[model samples]
Target: MTPKEYFKQAYRLDKRIDSQVVKLGELRALAGCAQTISYEEKIGSPNRNTEAPFVKVLEKVYLLENHINEQIDKFVDLKYQMADAIETLPNVDLGLVLDYRYLQGMTWEKIAEVMNADVRTIYRWHTKALQLVQMPENPIII
Candidate 1:
């Protein structure tokens, strides 16, 4: 893949990880909602039936949480690999540019702000960084 594509993949994975975190939060909230108990239920009523549904919801939440955690791990690992690749570049400015753009998911403007350089300079460095990026022969797994 091209350097731009590799960086885009990192950005995409960052977004997916963020969305999964939100989903995990929502699932936890749902699990909390499922735990509510109504004390005013009539005697001998079907209130006991709530346990089964609540248990099922909790189970689903547990599974989803695990899945999200695994996905986060994989994405984080890929980001680390990307960072390693960026470090291989000889130019410090190019490494910084690629790191900010890919690993940190920063915009060109933001990267310029952080680097204390002009946006045009940042763009130029980005082009050079792409040229310097060395992709691994085998893509990182996970």
Candidate 2:
């Protein structure tokens, strides 16, 4: 595989890892909320009336939380690995474009607006960035 394609794949993987992290954070918050609600129910119900159901539900929530946390950790590790690989190359523009387009989830038009360039220019930059990543030794700076 070409080095540029390799870098692009790394960048895509980084984006996926980032997305998983956000999902994991949401899942963790949900789990915490569920646990708190269960705790409140347990406390309100006197004579330990809801003890069994509360324990059952809490167990499930804890399990899900553990699963989500594990996935988040895995993704975080992957992000670091990909970042390290990309760091070996010298083309910073490729990294910048990928960050703005994929990580920031910005449209090409929006990216052009932010860069104060025409949409066609931004498209050209992105294309060149992809190519440069493939062969950093003789890059065509856009």
Candidate 3:
């Protein structure tokens, strides 16, 4: 993979985790909404099923949360890998640019502000940084 593609893996994972969290929140809300589930069973004899009405939704929420946790773990590991790779750059300036853009996932404007440099200069540094990037032996695959 190209350097930019390799660096973006963490960002993609982060976004996926965020989306799962939002879905989990919505699922929790739906599970908690008792009014949404019917209390009345058949008008005839009582059903033999012992399972609670909302148990499925609650289980779904829990499963989603677990999935999100797993994704977060992946994201953390990927960040550490990326940071280590960035630190290996020959030039400190190039390393800083890679760290901000890839590890921290900062935008050009924010990186420029943090580094007290113009956006154009930051872009130049970023281009150079990508050129100097040595792809890790085992980059995290999306």
Winner by TM-score: 3
lDDT of candidate 1 over 1-142, digit per residue (tens): 6768766776677677788778878877776774555588566766556455557767877887888788778787788788888889999999999888888778888999999999999999999989978987666643
Between prediction 1 and prediction 2, the one with superior lDDT is 1
TM-score of predicted structure 2:
0.50
Which ranges of candidate 1 are over 4 A from the true structure? 34-51
Show where candidate 3 strays beyond 4 Å.
35-48
Which candidate, 1 or 3, has the higher lDDT?
A: 3
Q: Please list the residue runs of candidate 2 whose C-alpha ends up more than 4 Å from where it truly belongs after superposition.
A: 1-51, 85-89, 134-142
**Which structure is stronger by TM-score: 2 or 3?**
3
* Model 3, span 39-137: residue lDDT tens: 876566476565786788889988998888888888888898888888888888889988988778889899999999999998898888888878889
Higher-ranked by TM-score: 1 or 3: 3
State the C-alpha lDDT per candidate.
Answer: 0.80, 0.57, 0.85
- The best candidate by lDDT is 3
Give every collision pair in model 2.
4-133, 4-134
